[model samples]
Target: MEKETDSSEMFIDPVCLMKVDSGNKNLMFTHQTRTYYFCAESCRKRFAGNPDKYLSNKSPKRKGLWGRYLDRLNKTTGGKSLNCH
Candidate 1:
């Protein structure tokens, strides 16, 4: 027997592990700090207009396991990893 997988599972963001909302997957990308989930391109645009306000919780200097991993990976991969940005 084969296991069934949901299509929604493919849209989940790996860093946040949250299902992408129905409409705006195309507007997705990881910025310097956090993983943003938008409902539309306009919403993402709005976010870009003042990213600092929305991304206050995602400081680049904030230290954690993920931060350390990104630092090491950045050095090894020459910053090729998408997650590093």
Candidate 2:
């Protein structure tokens, strides 16, 4: 469970919630302060089209309830994290 030391090995594709080999640097992107991997370029583009939607629906480990609440605030506050996390 301790994958912090090796993110690529533990990488998970947010769009599909599928495990992805960290070595697939060609199919990944970073947003905010997180890295996301995709099985295909199409997935990447879809995510980029509406990241917040995908992010808001993300796993709790990615953004706790409080963090998500803060995210909503950002939408109304000119897209800036409240730094509440």
Candidate 3:
């Protein structure tokens, strides 16, 4: 069972910055009394795992898996460029 969505109403998914329909009942989560919509279940899970991470106004922008891996690689190499023969 799903609610009827007003096509005019849209919400931004905090985790992925994707537009979600306001009436998306399945992919919604409530935190601190506020309801949020997500583009997918994975985004919902990520938000549920750490709501504050998405809610904090001063937190660093969230990155994708490849971005995170690149950041970690940079840290491991002290920001040195990796050269392959």
Candidate 4:
């Protein structure tokens, strides 16, 4: 049988906020009477270990363009800041 790829059937992974297929029963966990789907086993394990961390009331902070650039720079330069003249 062929599986349908419907957006309505997609569930967000609580840990990473990635879209997960609801039909993928293997990468899912239940908590507080709600079933959470995951895109990977690592995300599922993280959520299962600390459900409250991902389910917290606080939303993720949005980083601006400069902030994103700095993050990428830091990652690529091994924490060494480079000044362009």
**Of the candidates shown, which would achieve the greatest lDDT relative to the real structure?**
3
lDDT of 3 by residue, 1-85 (tens): 7756665799999998888887768999999898999999999999999988877743557676678899999999999988876
State candidate 4's TM-score: 0.59
Superposing all C-alpha atoms, what RMSD in Å does each candidate have to the true structure?
13.2, 12.1, 6.4, 6.5
Q: What is the lDDT of candidate 1?
A: 0.60
Off by over 4 Å in 4: 1-8, 57-85
Question: Which whole-number lDDT from 0 to 100 does residue 63 have in model 4?
Answer: 65
Q: Write the per-residue lDDT of candidate 4 for residues 1-85, one digit (tens) a residue.
A: 7655563688889888878889888998999999999999999999999999888723457564568899999999999878687
Off by over 4 Å in 1: 1-19, 22-24, 57-85
lDDT of each: 0.60, 0.77, 0.86, 0.85
> Could you tell me every candidate's TM-score relative to the true structure?
0.35, 0.55, 0.59, 0.59
Residues 6-84 of candidate 2: C-alpha lDDT, one tens digit per residue: 6546666777767777767789888998888888888888888888877777556687667878788888888865567
Give the alpha carbon lDDT tens digit for every residue of 2-37 in model 1. Answer: 644443543543343345653454866567765566
**How far out, in Å, is residue 27 in model 4?**
0.5
Pick by lDDT: 1 or 3, better one: 3
Candidates in descending TM-score order: 4, 3, 2, 1
Ten-residue segment with the worst summed lDDT in candidate 4? 57-66
Instruction: Sort by lDDT, best first.
Output: 3, 4, 2, 1
